[model samples]
Target: MDVDGEERIAAPREVVWHALNDPEILRQCIPGCQSLEKTSPTELVTTVRIKIGPVGATFNGEITLSNINAPESYTISGEGKGGIAGFGKGAADVVLIEDGDETILRYAAKAQVGGKLAQLGSRLIDSASRKLAQQFFADFNAAVAADGQT
Candidate 1:
């Protein structure tokens, strides 16, 4: 599966970047995310409850950052296992650019799934992934804006 998308946040680049990396902001933005922790400057550990169609599982994963350019761009790759439900791994290249006072967040991501998830078919996976990504960014934008207002 591949995901190519972008969102323009109505905030400064610095504000967008700060919200992007903040654990609290991320947890609130990521759907089904129960916990997220920064194990290292370039690594994150996460736990999320996922439900696709009739399958539900808890995924515990670690994500590593590479090709980082700080507040501008980075590459993230992560793999997660949900017991018998199977495993998922994905890589995304994210870029951020200033658009006046706003920041545009662009990303290209590819993913592979195995086990029960793959059995559900590509259409389902693709739809779910896009929905999740959209929700995350929407939440992120709202959170960032709220923080600025307060």
Candidate 2:
């Protein structure tokens, strides 16, 4: 599945960039993310719980950032396993464009699933992925805006 979207954040590009790299901020913004630990400047280990259709499971994953260009752009890829539920892997390219005091965040992502999760059908998985992406961005925008105010 492919997913892409853009969001306008009421903060500077630098602030947005920092928030994106900060594990604490990411943990707060990512939907279903139970914990996120940054093991290195370019890698993070995470635990996330999600429910799709009639199945619910917790997934452990590692995400790595590459082709980083500071407050400009980067590519992130990760894979997760949920035991009997299934597994998922995906990659996203993110760009941050400065718009005066605000920043325009854009992303293009693709994901794949296997096992029981894949058996649930593409339509269902696509819908769920889109929703989760939307939620994460909304939360991220709000959190960054709020953080800027403090």
Candidate 3:
């Protein structure tokens, strides 16, 4: 499945870009993220707990940032394994455009899932995916915006 959207964050592009790379900020922004450890400048290992429908699972994943353009844009990719629950892999192309004092954060993401998670039906999975994405960006936007205020 694919999902895309944009958020207007009340912060400069540089601030938003820095927040995107901060493990602490990302851990707080991501829904269900249990832990996020930065292993390298562009790589992180994470654990996230999520429930879709009635199946609840903990996913261990690795995230990588590439195609970086510094304070501008980058591609974020990750894959997670949830044991019997399923496996998921996805990539997102994120672009940060400066809009005066704020930043317009746009993303195009593609994802795929297998195992029990896929058996849940496409409609359900798609809906859940969109909701999760929205939640993450909303939280991220708020966090960055609040930080800018201080």
Candidate 4:
């Protein structure tokens, strides 16, 4: 499944980029994310509880950041396993563009599923993924805006 979206944050590219790399900020922004640990400058490990339709599970995931261009663009690869629930692996290409006092964050992401999660089909998976992504960004924007850090 594939999902993409763009959000305009009322903050400079640098500030937005910094927030993106902060595990504390990410832990708060990610929907259902109970914990996030920055094991290194380019790797993050996360634990999240998810509810899709009637199925609920906890996912443990690792996200790796690469192709860094400072406060410009980067690529992220993530993989998660939910035991009997299923597993998912995906990668995203993210570009942050400067828009005066704001930043335009664009992303293109794709994922592959296995186990029970794969039985749900692409439509359901795509919809859920898009909603989760949207919620994360909205929370992130709100957090940064609240701090007046952007």
Candidate 5:
């Protein structure tokens, strides 16, 4: 599956960039994220719970950031196993553009699933993925806005 979208944040590009790289911020923004720990500057260990169709599982994963260009852009990739529920792996390219005082964040991602998740059908998985992505950006925008006001 392929998913891509853009969001406009009411903050400076630098601030948006910082939030994107911050594990605490990501932990709060990611839907069903149980934990996200930075194992290294470019790697993170994560646990997330997800429910799709009739399958619910907790996935342990490692997310890696590469081709990083600081406050501009980077590529992130990860894979997780959800026991018998299945497995998922994906990669995303994220870019940040400064629009005066605001920031425009854009991403293009590709994902694949195997096992029970794939059996659930592409429509269901795509819908769930899109909803999760939207929720993450909404939460992230709110968090960044709140932080700026403080």
Candidate 6:
């Protein structure tokens, strides 16, 4: 599945960029995230719990950042294994554009799933994916805006 969207954050591009790279910030913004740890400058390990349809699973994943251009754009990719529930892998190209005092964050993403997740049907998976992405961005926006105010 493919998803594309943008968010206007009430912070500068540099602040948004730093927040995006901060594992603590990411853990707070990502729905269902149990833990997120940065193991390297360009990599992180994460655990998240999620339910798709009737299947609930805990996913352990490694996320990598590539093609990075500081305060500008990068490609973020990851693969998660959920035991029998399924496996999910996806990549997103994210860009941070300056919009006066705020930042316009844009992303284009593609994802694939296997095992029980794929058996659940594309429509359900797509809807769930979109919802999760929206929730993440909303949380991220709030977190960054609040930080800027402090």
Inter-residue clash pairs, candidate 1: none
Better of 3 and 4 by lDDT: 3
Model 2, span 1-150: residue lDDT tens: 999989898999999999999999999988899999999999999999999998889999999999999989999999999999999999999999999999999999999999899999999999999999989989999999999999
Candidate 3 all-Cα RMSD: 0.8
Candidate 5, superposed: residue stretches over 4 Å from native:
none
Between which residue pairs do clashes occur in model 4?
A: none
What local distance difference test score does each model get? Answer: 0.91, 0.95, 0.94, 0.89, 0.96, 0.96
Task: For candidate 5, give the lDDT.
Answer: 0.96
lDDT of 6 by residue, 16-77 (tens): 99999999999999999999999999999999999999989999999999999998999999
Q: What TM-score does candidate 6 reach?
A: 0.99
Error of 4 at 45 (Å): 0.9
Question: Clash totals for all models, in order?
Answer: 0, 0, 0, 0, 0, 0
Q: Residue 117 deviation, candidate 3, in Å?
A: 0.4
In Å, residue 101's CA in model 5 sits off its true spot by: 0.8
**Position 108, candidate 1: lDDT:** 99
* TM-score per model over all chains: 0.96, 0.98, 0.97, 0.96, 0.98, 0.99
Model 2 C-alpha RMSD vs. true structure (Å) is 0.7
CA displacement after TM-score superposition, residue 47 of candidate 4 (Å): 0.5
Ranking by lDDT: 6, 5, 2, 3, 1, 4
* Cα error, candidate 1, residue 107 (Å): 0.5
Best by TM-score: 6
Off by over 4 Å in 6: none
Candidate 4 per-residue lDDT over residues 40-142, each given as its tens digit: 9999999999977666789999999999998999999999999998998999999999999999999999899887888887788878888899899999999
